[model samples]
Every structure is written in C-alpha cells, then in structure tokens.
Target: MSLDAPYIARAAKPGQFVQIRCNDSFEPLLRRPFSIHRVKGEGSRVKDIEILYEVVGKGTEILAGKKEGDFIDVLGPLGNGFILPRTTNHERRTTNSEPRAIIIAGGIGAAPLVYLAEELTKKKIKTIILIGAKTKNLILCEKDFKKATPEVYISTDDGTYGSQGFVSKLFHKILKTTESKFETIVYVCGPHGMLKCIVDICQERKFECHASLEEKMACGIGVCLGCAVKTKSGIKLACKDGPVFNASELIW
Candidate 1:
C-alpha cells in the first residue's frame, strides 16, 4: 500500500514501521503494524511511503479493500531503524576493503529489508539477500531485491523453487563458503523460529546480527507496554524501543 505522506516518507528509514487503522469503526479497535517497505521519490522531495502486508485476518481484509484515493489513518515511522554501514575512506577508493552485508527475509518479512538493501548498495557495500518461504508463491519481493544486488538466494520449505530448506541453513552455508575477509553484518526479519536459528548461528560464528521482530501491539507508542520483549537489558517495548534489535541483546 502506497500512502501519500510526504512527511513520513522524508523521515522514514529502513526497518522502521507504520501502524494503520483498517476502519474508522471500533470493530478492530487497535491498528495493525506494517513495515515501511520502500519510500518513493528522490533527494529531499519524497512523495510517498509504501507498506507491504498480507490479508491474514479481518483487519488486513478491510485494509485490502481500501481504494487508492481513500484516506487512511496512519501513525508512522515508528521505532528505531537499522544502523547502516558507514562508508569508509578506503572503501571509497577501492573494492578490496569494502564491507559485506547480508539480508535474510522469511515469507512476508521480506518487506522492510528492500529499502536497507538499496541503501547498502548505494554505498557500494557488497549486499546479499536470502529469501525463504513455504512455497514459491509465498516468496515476496524477489524482483525488488534483485534491483539492489544480484546475489539474491531463495529457498522454499517444500522445494518448489530455489533451494529446498530453511533460509537460515542457506545463510550458514554462505558464511562457511564465502572467502571475503572484510567485516560482515547480517540483518534478518522472519518467523520467531527462524530468527532464533539465525541468531544462534551468528553467535557461534561471531558475526554481528540484527533482527527485525514482528509482534502484536495494542499501542504504537511507548505506553501500554503491550508488545514488550525480553532482552539482555530487561523488558523493552517492540513499538517504542525497537522492532529492530541487535541479536546479542535479544534473549531468544
């Protein structure tokens, strides 16, 4: 869903999200949180912000029915965003010392990372993306990610397309086989099980990992504490503190 919100588009960063109200009525009561997929326009004149969502239930079903010109109640650019890699002096002059970054997306979680991949590519960082879904039809944003980097690997649980297995396993294989000596960072968004698996691998391999978590929220702000997550530093609100957190800070 593309929204004509220039203010949000200008301020939005990769890994931040928005909460949208499906209807004006109290049927759903709370809003639904969706990752800011991509921002449209260039320079300081952004025109619109886009969000990707699936019609899982009533709220999204109603959201799917919205017309293009329809006004939507959106509360946005929420939570902390991913920390992008800074361009080093050496990287500007040569490709030998360039940093490498990897993105792992599971199912609909592929939405937010497209923006991150684009930003990394613009900085000339070697960016790779691993996308996983249950089947080929469920895979999201393959074409969009390929625009940023050519190293897009895909896997499905049922072996319908690409590799036949979990994406986390594919990541492990890449980490093991790759000969690049530059620093590497991994960013991931996916099912809880997949996140945990990737985090474990990162921990064992000593690679820095960042994860975008998906959680239910009653309030998009810090109040209510409905979407609290346990981290190394105690409880943190997913809506306010983060939807993106360092893998080391997370408990599970």
Candidate 2:
C-alpha cells in the first residue's frame, strides 16, 4: 500500500520501518510495524511511501480492507537502518572491480530489501538477490527487484519455482563455491531458523553480514521493552535499537 507521508518517505532509509494503526477501535490496541517497502517520487521530491504486508492476523486483515483515500494513522521511519558500504570500509579486489552484495530474503522478507537493492544499484555496487518461497505464487517482489538488479535468484521449497530446495541450502552452496578473491557482503531477513543458519554460514565464511529481525512489537517505541533481542553486547530493543542489526552483534 502506498501512503502519502512525504516526510516519512524522505527520511526513511533502507531497512527502516513504520508503525501503523490498523483500525480506530481499541480492540487491537497496539499498532503494527511494517518495513518501508519503497519510496515513491522523483528527484528530491518523495510523494509517498509503500508497505508490503501479508494478512496473517486481524490487524493486517483490517489494514488490507482499507480503501484508497482513507487516512491511516502511521508513525514513521523508525529503527536503525542498513549501513551502506563506501570505499573506506568495504574491500575491493581490484581498482576497477566493484564490491559485491548478496541479499537473501525469504517470503515477505523481500519487502525491505527492494529499497536496499535499489540504493545499492545507484551506488554502482554489484547486487545479487536470492528470494525464497514455499511455492511459485508466494514469491514477492521479483519484478521490483529485477528493475533494480538483474542478478535475482529464486527458490521454492515445493519445487514449484526457480529452484527446488530450501533457500538456505542454496545460499550455503553459493557461499562455499564463491571465490575468496571477490569481496562480498550479505544482508538477510527471514524466519528465525533461516536467519540463524545464514548467520552461521556468514560467520564461517568471514563475510560481513547484517540481518533485519522480524519481531512482534507491543509498543513500537522502546518503552514496553516488548521486542528485546539478545545480542553479544547485551539486551537490545528491536523496535528502537534495531530491526536491522549487524549479524555479528547478535548472539544467535
């Protein structure tokens, strides 16, 4: 859904999200958090922001039924965002070769990465995206990602899509076969099991990695401490301290 929130659109960074009030009734007291799917506008003029969501619960079901031109309450551009690689931090194999970025998304997790991939393309970085779904119809953002980068891979667990296998398994094979000469970074957003597996692979490969954590938030702000994650440093709030965190920083 596209929302006419100009300031939120302008300020939103890749991996950042927004808290939306699903309905006016107090039945569902808390607002739901959604990643900023994409920003819509032209040069320096951000008209609106988009949100990609699944109707997994009553809140999202209510949101899904809202018509266009309706005013929805939204609290914006929240949480820490992804850090882009510049020349100083990222390694380059050769003077002419650019740094490579590998993005792994499972199901609706692909939502946030579309914005990131577009930004990466604008920086002229080589970006490859791997999207996983249960079936061919469950895949998200293939066309949007293709517009951003040509190198997009798809995997479905049911053998109904591009590749027939778990996406994590495919990712491991790719990492194992990749040459050490190329500098690569990975970004992932998915199920806990998938995230943990990918984190292990990245750790073993010694690749810089970041992950967008999907957690339930009671209070979108940090107050309730509802969305706490155990990190290497200490306990951190997912709603405020992250949603996006460096993979190394997480205990998992």
**TM-scores of the models, in the given order?**
0.95, 0.94
Best by TM-score: 1
Candidate 2 lDDT for residue 11:
91
**Shift in Å, residue 172, candidate 2:** 2.6
Give the local distance difference test score of model 1.
0.90
Clashing pairs in 2: none
Q: Which candidate's lDDT is highest? A: 1
Instruction: Give candidate 1's error at residue 68 in angstroms.
Output: 1.5
Candidate 2 local lDDT, 150-199, one digit each (tens): 88889999989888888888897676776655577899998888888888
Clash count per candidate: 0, 0
Compose the digit string of candidate 1's lDDT tens values, residues 10-29: 99999999999899999898
The lDDT per prediction is 0.90, 0.89
lDDT accuracy of residue 193 in candidate 1 = 94
Which portions of model 1 miss their true places by more than 4 Å? 89-97
